[model samples]
Target: MTTTIRNGIMIAAMALALGACASKGAPTSQFDFGPLPAAAPASASSIGAIIVADVTGPAALDTERMHYRLLYSDARQSRPYAYNQWTSTPSQLLTQRIKASLAQAGVKVLSTTDAAASTTVLRMEVEDFAQNFDSATASSGVVRLRASVFRMHRLVDQKTFSRSVPAPSADAAGGARALADASDAVAADLLGWLAALPPSKE
Candidate 1:
């Protein structure tokens, strides 16, 4: 009977130690871009359909971590948060937002799996996506993307969009909010740019 009791106590103590270790190494918080606004109604001149290619970025922006820069320390240097991360890769999130925004605006957005005749295609490359800290208390979310419009495999137009939104705080949460706001602005501009182009011919 005494042996049995001693073994049970040891088992319980081991369990508690394991639980404490798990709690200490809990999973980090993850985030997404948040809700997107409803797309504006499609204009009569909107193209019939267009393909949105997956956005690509550098190794840093291509990751799921929330990245930031201490401009005061090194304007050209950046670092990622260890405990805060994005639910999806930054490029992936940006691509989803772009497609959703275009569709909401009444544009016919197509995926790579869709089959269609020669159609206009939009290619985007993310050059920069990070929070920049001018001071310990001040920061800004900066986003830069290069957009190219193609019609029936022919390049029609290309432009680069760069935006900086002031962050409410110098943290990941604030960066996320600022980035979301900048994304909306970029989407609106993309809508207008695509709408002005002539429809593609198969």
Candidate 2:
């Protein structure tokens, strides 16, 4: 090809790339659910250290994208917010909250990575985690999780906890705050349930 033609093509390609980038605009700002509730009050009896197992859930709820349901449209269909996302998967964030809650309650909390440190394990199965919109003007955050206690690889106790908190606003930020509140409520409930159980078996 002629040098003139080649230079023209290169310039055109560069301009096209620049235009595409500019049209895309700046990246969306990322947001995360707030930290879990403050630690539970200290317990008089010391619970042995326990490891938090990785929480499991469906593909949609298992991800970091903020999910929601439109009750006015398709209550069963789940949708994601393109501009909003979590810092990590919902399960991972919930696991961290649970660990913090337990530790605050005077229980020695170990992470899943520290399996050798404790025989007692707490496994959580997340059932639901999303914002439900009853109308364009109103919404609430909902979270449901089932927790199981295992001692020496054997299931000892299990229970389910669910919570829904009203969103102060109808947008993503409001939904995130409500979800955080719901998560904290669930964590508190789980801690209370664990406190009622007998000490971990050797």
Candidate 3:
């Protein structure tokens, strides 16, 4: 009887200890791009249909981790912020954002699987996507992307777009805002670029 009682007490103690350990870890914060700006009405000049391919990037950016760099200290070393992360990979987020922007501009955004349905394809690759700290108290979010436009599998145009926005603070929250701002800026510029392209013969 005594042995059974002692075993029960030990089990209870172990449960409590495990519970404490599980709850002791810091809580992680998740973020997204937030609401996008209202898109203007589609005009007759807009591209008819397009397929925005899934964005591709370096292996480092393939995860949900939030990345940052201390340019003033060691520019080559990119670090992930603790207890802060994105809802998805940087590539996925940016791809969704670009598709939304294209649809808003009156372009019919199609899926890559619908290749036969569209002649124009837009492919983007991440060149830079991280918050960069220039000093102990100053930081900015920078995003760079190479955009390629293909018509009927033929490359028509390619360009690189970039935006850097000053962070309001030197923390995850600030980085999120700055990055979103930079992303929006780049999307706007891309929208204009798409509008200016020569009218497709198809």
Candidate 4:
């Protein structure tokens, strides 16, 4: 081929590559827990006016990215979706959900910033928060959190809550819905545990 023709073909390929990159750079779609379901009837609680501390999580989950893992291919590597993100960090989302769920159940949920005297405090740490795929077409949202209840600096009790809910679809939207469900399930379990506790001696 002539040198002129070869240069023209190379330039065309570069233009096409740049065009593809620009398309990929389009704005990403953001997500959150969406909305909590219709709450059940509120009931009286012995655990009254408790405080909820901010949730802490690994550095990976400290961002707004939507994370997922392909267990069938590479289980150790977690990847973020190219065109989707979370409206907030995973820890923040969980914090909001837990507080809302507790309030809906008739617990007097208070934030750490709120004034309280010798009130019960709940602290939580995120262990794992990601969508894992069993196969190319199947996945589940998984959440693992460790919670500690304290009163006047004394550890009252500690427990870990976890859930793995199957996604409706294999995409990011499905993952978000599944994670919201799993989070709600965990929050409900935490409520049960809290309710079973005897009134604090304080």
Candidate 5:
């Protein structure tokens, strides 16, 4: 009986030791929090006769400083995710991104200081820049953006674009992860649209 009790204790101790070694650290999902997605190519051809003014913003909503929340199944219930607020103006950052995308599309960006010299001004007015938590059960987040485009001082186009990006809704452990994912989605769509615009003439 004594021998059996001693062996039992020894086996228990060994099991505990093995469990400690096998323990994985905090539960972290293998999720990617990378830059935004890229936009599709625009159908418009390069208009060489016009000088494209770089994309300008603050034209709409200030998303950089906006706080984001995820609403699950019910509209009344929501989970607060990471804050999208930015110290800098959202328009300034957006303009820079737009300029880069235009450059990549072979568009010549006219100087902002020379507004009159620009053959056509690319004005983007942001309307709604906010993240909406549409469904909670599916672990999904939606980003909505409303913008207006101007050409020759006239409203040429206006529309709202919304994207449903995946969010990690496991728990608070993955709140930042989910928000980051949503943010990237928004940025990617915005860049893709900006990139598709036709370049101005040299």
Candidate 6:
């Protein structure tokens, strides 16, 4: 009877230890931003009389793409385990989306490379592109964008936009989905803003 009691105590202690270890292994409830989505399709807008130069931005050396780095307001590691997971290189993805939106609005866009062409130049500077977490729920992803438009070396307009969108609830897919959703929101906001701007004249 004494031997049976001793064995029971030993088994209970081992089970407690194992349970503690499992709890420790779980990932902390921290926010993890993921990569942006592939660029969307261009607009059918007549690319009117306006010619937009190729968008420019800070180099994303990590990805060799122009639009890279999910700029954080504070100094925090972007993701815990994944490097470059949330970074998006600025490419035709954003430009195409903007183009498509403008096309829909019947705005003309010109090419930036053609300096000799007599057309109003539209230059866009993407200041901040990132996904933000809600203070109440860190897991809930929100999209934020800050950008400005320039015409003829003058700042025509600037704005900051944000939106709350559904993110993946599962751990396996959460980060990626957050990134894509954020990008989509940014693109949509940018297009809407551009559509509202007064047409530039040479």
Model 2 scores a C-alpha lDDT of 0.78
Model 5 TM-score is: 0.48
Candidate 4 weakest lDDT stretch, 10 residues: 13-22
**What is the Cα-based TM-score of model 3?**
0.85
lDDT of 2 by residue, 9-120 (tens): 5675454334323434556546666655556465625467888887888887667787777786678887766656788888878777777777777778888789888988
Off by over 4 Å in 1: 1-27, 40-44, 115-118
C-alpha lDDT of residue 153 in model 3: 81
Candidates in order, TM-scores: namely 0.82, 0.81, 0.85, 0.85, 0.48, 0.51
Q: Could you give candidate 4's per-residue lDDT for residues 34-56 as a string of tens digits? A: 88887655453777878899899
Q: Model 4 reaches what TM-score against the true structure?
A: 0.85
Write down the worst ten-residue block by lDDT for model 6: 64-73
Tens digits of per-residue lDDT for model 6, 124-161: 55544433433212334444545666666677777876
Q: Candidate 3's residue-wise lDDT over 1-202, tens digit each?
A: 5999777756754543343234446798898889987865545256778888999999977899887776755799887776789999988989998888877777789989998898999999999999998865578999999999999889999999999999998777788889988988898888888888887888
Runs in model 4 deviating more than 4 A are: 1-23, 41-44
Regions of model 2 farther than 4 Å from truth? 1-27, 40-46
Candidate 6: TM-score? Answer: 0.51
lDDT of 1 by residue, 131-179 (tens): 8877666788888899998876778999898888999876778988888
The local distance difference test score of model 6 is: 0.48
Collision pairs in model 3: none
